[model samples]
Target: MAAGGPPPVLGVDACRGGWVGVLLALGRPSVALFAPRAAELVARAGAAAAALTVVGIDIPVGLSAGGPRQADLLAARELGARRSSVFRTPSRAALEAPTHAEANARSRAAGGEGVSAQAYALRTKVLEVDAWLRDRTAGPRVVEVHPELSYAVLTGAPARHPKRTWAGSEERRAALRAAGIELAGDLGEAGERAGPDDVLDAAVAAWSAARVATGAARSLPDPPEELEDGVLAAIWA
Candidate 1:
């Protein structure tokens, strides 16, 4: 998997509300969104995983005590992540605890902005899910993506979207329509931008997937190490 060229890139925009996966091949990204079901994500990730190397998922891929806790955080710091982010704090106390899952379920059940933080944390579980994906699957290496820093890579500069939000289905369809791409779903209205925001995020996440897939994305890790708990070598400095 580590031999030929860089591995395919996989990007996951995970949240408590739901999660999205972007798989990019050649130079295009394929998009999928769901409620972050473990079994389903692994299955959905199959296409790009076959030839993957570097993955840029929009989730915090490590634990932290004060700062960014994951490998991506080191990347983010290099990329200039402004202001500290609670980001993907654990929803549960123990890694094996049900608190995180329960929090996720509760957030999903509430709807609205209720699950904002939990959504971020949901990526942790998704990361675990990614691990399971690799163990059973036979292609591509996967890595976590920090959404903000990822945008920096995508645009060649870091930019924050304070008011910007992920676009919903109809919104994405609208943008695709404007761009002359076929809409995958029916959008009941056009004035709504939130829907579009979610879609745009998914697209960006897809871009991350594509970059890692095609060797366009660079990894800071000199001698890349297999990810594990409490390993400083896991991150590039």
Candidate 2:
């Protein structure tokens, strides 16, 4: 832990400038910050990094070589109408491709469906996180997370509105409050750069990270698949 308190947990989400991270301790949000990279965001926790319990991030951690990940399929199934939020992760080969056309071709050749434009757009962030995890030293247990899945588990149903909408943002905030984390007052520059949805997503990801620390979270695939580099391919909530 950090000094005398329990270990801190983190939730991170990709934002316009870079990444938004929420650090929680004793089940409450302690700080929120924005960083240009994942490592810098984690370093925001300082001493806590050495004893950080879990880190939940809204990105695909492990890429499948053969086809679409079962974890993504299961998360979509769980979301029902909100299933579209869970994009199919491109195969490792597709992720390494230089262009969308190349990615789609690689995906198809690997027995996976064509990559969606949205999913393709995230290739950089996905690969960044993947590489980070591979080179990570012993600090926190990082896991793949989906904000929609976290919100669904918290509210006991899929979110009724899109996160970018006012109603949807309100719904997500309510879910966070209901789970005992409140987001109020000023959040400094972090709040300025990240959108409301990005903040909310990071908050909920922290909630899931707490659950993971306490052994209460559930993975989309109970037995998470392992990538060759040893990253677990599963979405936890």
- Candidate 2: worst 10 consecutive residues by lDDT? 1-10
Which candidate's lDDT is highest? 2
Worst 10 residues of 1 by lDDT: 186-195
lDDT of 2 by residue, 100-205 (tens): 9999999888778999999999888989988888787766889889999999999899999999999998888888877777776688878999999999999999
Which tens-of-lDDT digit does each residue in 1-237 have in candidate 1? 113423344445444445555444443334344534534554565643564554444544444322223454356465664424323343222233346555545444434122344444455564566456445645444454454454555445555443154343343444434432332443222112224444445445555555556656555454443434543222211
Best by TM-score: 2
Task: Quote each prediction's TM-score.
Answer: 0.54, 0.93
Each prediction's whole-model lDDT (CA): 0.44, 0.86
**RMSD in Å for model 2:** 2.6
lDDT of 1 at 72: 41
